[model samples]
Target: MIDKRLRVVLAEDSVVLRDGMVELLGARGCEVVAATGTAPELLAAVAAHRPDVAVVDIRMPPTHTDEGIRAAVDIRARTPEVGILVFSQHVETVWASRLLADGTAGVGYLLKERVARTSEFVDALRRVADGGTALDPAVVTQLLRGGQRHKVDALTPREYEVLELMAQGHSNRSIATLFAVSERAVEKHVAAVFAKFGLRATDTDNRRVKAVLTYLAESGS
Candidate 1:
């Protein structure tokens, strides 16, 4: 459950879908600060509201091809604090990579049909709002398959497992629980994964994000 009420800006070209999402999010205790249909309107709404998160569709007005994702990228450039959740029917790996080019924090990409449950959607949104990732497993799989074979191959099986869970936005404690291991064990695995990826502690960079970035970059997705 979301610890705090979230203020959101929603962008979807389909009026029915947009309205439905507004109502659904409201029912789930989120305040829809603004709901828009076009990319321009979506950008304006986000700039005006500075919402906790923005739920965006990949297609929008005019061309309806990739305006939404473009707007999302722009939002990332101009308002890094606003979390973005790309909810689309299609999985555009190129668009996903572009959205996550700079960082993974406060980002999520989930296929609409795969969401299955409202609770899951809300949980993903909450995670993104809290500066965490919420990538779909399919997306993670594609990224993993595309990454540099040599780099990926260097990890031990356990380290690879930890990396996958990390990409899915699982905290060390959560990963530990899932593996039925101690948190310290999870941390060791995480550290091993980081070391294998050549990620080191830095004042200006988040090693975890960098590790995920390396995974995505090598994937060329």
Candidate 2:
């Protein structure tokens, strides 16, 4: 169940790949409202169409180093409601951190390889468009193993488990189910995590995103 048609704007430098993506999205019932190769075009298309989601490539046109990422960040700032899914060949933890720094909801960073599996890729897009997250597990592993744990060293082992799952974009309920613990207990641990990180719990703020950002910040990822 896809309730409504998901509109998308795609940014990819490769013509072949871009065409393929358009076809794929169309087959999956997503309307490719606009597709562009350069970051500027992508941004403009997003502004014009205001699509439900934007599928961005990490490298596109000109320098191809971080143009897509820069565009993704811009889109996030300009249209918080529009989802962004970074599809990149390289797994740059720093870039992923920048994307999720503000929050993880309505955001996703998946390796380009994941697009090979049509169903999985489409599902990831849907998840992001629905104000959820879909971070690559490898991205999480890279951040954890990158050796930036001075602040995180203070967390208890159980807290570390909770944080890791959170970084993987799991909800509190999902984490509780995985640990087979009461949701209330999970809430306590999550609260403790926020306290340890010195993040204020407010109804207007997303504590989960802040907590994960703290994890990335500590790891310098």
Candidate 3:
């Protein structure tokens, strides 16, 4: 269950979609503090509202290409506290890599069409706002198909599935539910993933983030 209402700033060039998003978020117990149609407006709104999360489109305004992604990066540099979720119809691996280049916490990249279920979209947003990852399944597939297969090939089929879901930013509990397995099983798979990748145990290291980096590195994007 969600504990507190999340504040959001939405950016989309399409007025209809933007309005729909505002309404949808409101219905999901989120507060849409500001909504804009352009990148500049989005940056200004974010600065002014200091929202918990900013849902942005990849293409916006004049060029209709990469403006939203650029804005998201700017926000990450300026206000790392605010979560960013890039919602777009197009899946450009280069741009997606750019968005996640810094780190995964408080970041998400999801395809617009794939988010058919309202509950799923809200859950992703909630996860990002709370400083968790929420990558789209398509994003994960793209990475896996493009990434180096040698390391991934070593993983058992089930381990590969677990890694894929983990790369999609799902937590162990969520993954366990999806697989109809116990949390312990999910935990064991995660450990195996790290071990196969030769990740060292260190108090200062985040194995989850390291695993994601490995996926991206293999993807070469």
Number of backbone clashes in candidate 3: 1
Task: Please give each candidate's TM-score.
Answer: 0.72, 0.72, 0.71
Looking at model 3, report the run of 10 residues with the lowest lDDT sum: 141-150
Candidate 2 lDDT tens digits, 1-221: 66789999999999999999999899899999998999999999999999999999988789979899889989998899899999888876666667776768788888877556888899999989988777776676674454334556778999989987887667789899999999899888888888877778676676677678557556533
Model 1 lDDT tens row, 45-85: 99899999999999888987898998999999899999999
Give one digit per residue, the lDDT tens place, for model 3 in 1-221.
66799999999999998999899899889999999999999999999999999999999988999899899999998999999999989877666766676668789888988877999899989889988777775676674445444577678999889887776667899899999999999999989998998777886666676577566455532
Candidate 1 runs further than 4 Å off? 144-210, 213-221
Error of 1 at 133 (Å): 0.8
Q: Output the better candidate (2/3) by TM-score.
A: 2
- Separately for all candidates shown, the number of backbone clashes (residues 3 or more apart, or on different chains) is 0, 0, 1
What Cα-based lDDT does every candidate model obtain? 0.82, 0.83, 0.84
Candidate that would win on lDDT = 3
C-alpha RMSD values across all candidates = 6.5, 6.3, 7.1
RMSD value for candidate 2: 6.3
